[model samples]
Target: MKSEYILKTEEDTKNMAKEIAFDIKNKIIFLNGEIGAGKTTFTKYLVEAFGLKDEVCSPTFALENRYETENGLIIHFDLYRLKSEEELDMIGFYDTLKENATILIEWADKFNIEKYIKKYNIISFKIEDNNIRAVTIK
Candidate 1:
């Protein structure tokens, strides 16, 4: 199943994130979007919806950020800096999947991650006009 949302303001993005968070069940979510398309913003809201008070930031430099919440463990990964699939192993990507956690990966489409991950939720963000974002979840 697929769902689409139009995020015109920060409130819309926050509401969408809260709604989506309820559906995450030890799943991997692949976030697809260009820079400034609201991926990180939505992630911040999603983490908040999970009752986590920790600050959420893009892990572009560190590669991965782990959050331990009352709901469960949430791992956010940014694969933009990764040059090869081997680096995923170095980052313990596969090992992390074995844990009972919700995984959100940014720039996941950069690699052939679908081959390894059979089950996942793909949330794609497209810039429509005047900073409006069209987000689709599948």
Candidate 2:
């Protein structure tokens, strides 16, 4: 499935995230975009919709973060700083998918995830203007 939305403001982005949170099935999510394209921001709202009280921050340096939600665990990974695909192996990337959790990966381009992407949703963020974003899903 593919969908596109124009977010003129942060609120629009939030609304889109909320809708996706409830609509998207439990599967891996690959977020693709530039550094400031709001990939992390979109995941933040999705986590919020899952009943997380604390703020959601990117796992840039940490590599990953986990949020326990009523539905299940939400595993968010940022491979932006990953130097090689071997790092994913060291970090137990496949083990993560084996678990019963919703996985979302930012900077997924670091490695070839095509084999694991069949059941996943891909969301690409593009900055149209300041605070304006073009969000597309595939």
Candidate 3:
């Protein structure tokens, strides 16, 4: 099953994120969308909802970032620059999935790690014509 929402502005998107936060915890979330699709922005709101004390930024160049909260931990990953699946293997991505932390990945549509990614949530971000964004979750 899935749900879709039209977020007309950044604020609308954040509100949607808040709604999603209620259903998630220590789960893997794959963010799929093109560049400038607000993947990172939604990520920030989600992280904040979890009570992260610091700022949240895209792990674009850093590849990945880990944040701690009083309740648990969250790990954000950017796989846009990865040249090959071997690169992911080098980063111990598989092992990371076993850890006790919530995982959110930007540019996740690039990988075919279906076996490992199964049984997780998938968020698809789509840019609309009127400067709005369409977000779908399954």
Candidate 4:
């Protein structure tokens, strides 16, 4: 399944994330976008939708961050700084997949992990000029 949304403001992104958070069954989501894209912003709203009050920050340096919510754990990962596949193993990336938690990965396109994951969703964000963003989910 795939859908697209034109986000004109931060509120639009928040609503979209909230909708996806409630509707999507797939816990593993791959966030594809470049720097300055709304990946982190969307993530913040998604976490909020999950009933989490903890602040959400990019795990660019920390590799990953985990937030426990009423539903379950929401693990957000950023592969932007990962140097190699071996680093993934070192960071216990594969191990996390085995757990019963919602997983969101940024820079997932850095490596081909689709074969390893049985079920997942891909959400791509594209910046259209200064105030508009095109978000597509599959």
List per-prediction Cα lDDT, in the order shown: 0.89, 0.83, 0.86, 0.87
Q: Write the residue-wise lDDT of candidate 1 on 15-104 in tens digits.
A: 998887879757999999999898889888888999897799999999999888778888899998999989999989888877789999
What CA RMSD would candidate 2 show? 1.6
How do the predictions measure up, each by TM-score? 0.95, 0.92, 0.93, 0.94
Candidate 4 overall lDDT versus native:
0.87
Q: Write one digit per residue (lDDT tens) for candidate 2, span 1-138.
A: 339999887788788888888666467889999998888888888888888766889999999999998766889999998988788889998788777788899988778876765587889998875668888998
Which candidate should be chosen as best, given TM-score against the real structure?
Answer: 1
Checking candidate 3 for backbone clashes, the offending pairs are none
Clashing pairs in 1: none
Instruction: Name model 3 segments beyond 4 Å from true.
Output: none
Please tell me which model should have the higher lDDT, number 1 or number 4: 1
Return the TM-score for candidate 3, rounded to 2 decimals.
0.93
Q: lDDT winner among the candidates?
A: 1
Per-residue lDDT for 1-138 in model 3, tens only?
A: 338989899899788877887576798999999999998999888888888758889998989989887657889999999987889999988889888888898877788876776678889899989988998988
Clashes of each: 0, 0, 0, 0
Sort all candidates by TM-score, best to worst: 1, 4, 3, 2
Better of 2 and 3 by lDDT: 3
TM-score of 2: 0.92
Candidates ranked, most accurate by lDDT first: 1, 4, 3, 2
